[model samples]
Target: MTTTAPPEHPPAGSAPGSAAGRLWRAGRAPAAVIGLLVAVSVLLSLGSEQFPSGHLEPGSPEPDGARALVRLLDEDSDLTVARTSEAAVRAVERSGEDTVLVVLLDHRLLPEELDTLAGLGSDTVLVRPSLRSLAAFAPGADMTGRVDDERTLEPGCALPAAASAGDAGVTGELYTAGNGVEALGCYPAADGSGLLQVAAPDGSTTTVLGTGDPLTNRELDSAGNAALALNLLSAEDVVWLRPDVPEEVGSATLWELVPAGVRWSLAPLALTLLLFALWRGRRMGALVPESLPALVRASETTEGRAGLYQSRKARDRAASALRNGFLERSVPKLGLRTDSGPDSVVAAAAARSGEDPQDLWRLLYPSQPDPYTADDEAMLRLADELDRLSGRLR
Candidate 1:
């Protein structure tokens, strides 16, 4: 008669060599690619400066850059116009009293740097300056809010530049000067200030225009943008302080940079990951217990019993089982009858196992038969004794 053999399976560690295995392997590339894409997107969104520079760069031809305005200043007037961001006093001084420093960088400059620029001999014009920038360069000049005016705002103030510029797109951060501060606030929003001008004690002027639309290439032709931009920037000399992106002044951790909502959400994510790991690692089926025949090899039986005992932490039961099995084999080997008393079995086992007779007697015939107390070390010693006794007979 012909018989069929059982199907083979992959070993514990070996990857399966089948159609399913091939599919799994094939899926890995796409999975890795997707994960990498997600990681890159997250990094870009989190760190603002992670992307390339040139937001308002003068040299850049991008829509946001001041290249057109720089070119206009270079070509339109016969005055010296330098398209540079470096804080060089010598360049400004060389242009003499007619030098005008038009700072296009909005929020990049540090407080000290703005202060230094304000103190220069040249007339300064800061376009869309930050609060910190306002504090440093234009003292008493604080941004009020957004412009509420729907139409183009006129230069209502006495400043000649604003007056000549007429109605321009002054529809952004509104400014207000504090009391006793000798400054002219033109292009009046709902409140006092829009285009602020502070005359320094040394006669050098510091002008803070609320919007950059007047100078940008796209908006330069709009309303009186050209007129305003030229009036503000076209002195005998113009120093465009387009500062480089500044380094983070203070060191901060990744956790500190993360938003509060994102940080708070991580706890639930960690818990979900833990649950997923547990679910993935859990055993699929229940264990099936097996009983071996009495005629099984002594070592194999002993190893099987040891595994069971260890799983259940039944040290005492394991020790007793080991001793009983040894006695059953040894009594017959030493010529003692199967139904022999405990003393005789112990004496015979001790002689063969090379252990003390009294010690064997106590271990074999303990106070309790079913339940007894034995630690791991005692169980090990008992198993070793049985092995030695069985070996001697062989």
Candidate 2:
């Protein structure tokens, strides 16, 4: 007879020469894609100024008109112009000398602060450049003189002829003033004290110096308001109260502003991804068998076999496994017919061994019983008798 050859097994890890194997072997494309993404990110960050952490510097000093007035006061007056805040107001008030509180009121003051100024008595000279500021220091305190009735005026218009004559030798008659387009109207207090509202020298108050450009260094020299600047610095000891502009409280730094929660979440996700990558990169070792053994042992043989039986609904096959030993012992003792039906086999076994027919039936057929109601002792006794009888007969 001619010998037949065994079918060849596929080589371990070698491509099977199939469509799936060919697709899996094509790995260069994905590597190229990953390399392209990294290259793009690097190029963009290098070329673009708008990239994160791009070069940026704080803004250069802006031209502030108020700085001119501040410099003038610092130079001309016996006044020591020191920047102060709202917090220092009480301290300044407590000092209680004839204090010239030169407050740079950008907008109108609150009624309460204005009242506080009024309550300070005649010892205090409140020089406000704007009607709003005047309103703050002296609410309804004769704004008729502080603001001119006329709406317009000519340029280079001198102060009222009367004001020039009156303040000729007066010490603190013109306490503070501003030089700009929108000048607040100046007025004399009932006691002849000067409340020099920052207005144009002309009769018209409409050109009030709302823009403090004349006070700033850049425009102060250009605006030709040096005389007005000198008047504002007339006080012997002037206190410049520059309240800080209101800014958002508790603003975060660049690092603090970035959401840490998202970063932390991404970190964990990246760590998990790295672990998956390591798992994927690891080799599983050589796949081919070195030699054949008497029997091959599977790691989960019992569990896999049970699962297969369960999935196939093979109850009879499962019961056959349990009864295999019993059937071997009983065959000789009872001369049990191997090809007989379960009922006939069990009846013959009971008659030959003089055991309970029901017990023998349970051992052979094993009708599904309540898990809690199993007759374990009876089954054991039946097995023992069958074993003893099988030995004697043999």
Highest lDDT, which number?
Answer: 1
Residue 368, model 2, lDDT: 70
C-alpha lDDT (0 to 100) for residue 147 of candidate 1? 77
**Per-residue lDDT of 108-221 in model 2, one digit per residue for the tens?**
345565555445432233333445555544333332332222221222234542233232212122233333434333333333223334332332121123233334554445
For candidate 1, which ten residues in a row score worst on lDDT?
44-53
Deviation in Å, model 1, residue 153 alpha carbon: 0.6
246 in model 1: Cα distance from truth in Å?
A: 3.1
Per-residue C-alpha lDDT of model 1 across residues 155-214, encoded as one tens digit per residue: 898888889989988788788888887899888878655688987777877788877766
Each candidate's root-mean-square deviation in Å? 16.9, 18.9
TM-score of each: 0.47, 0.34
Against the true structure, whose TM-score is highest? 1
The stretch of ten residues in a row with the least summed lDDT in candidate 2 is 51-60
Backbone clash pairs for candidate 1 read none
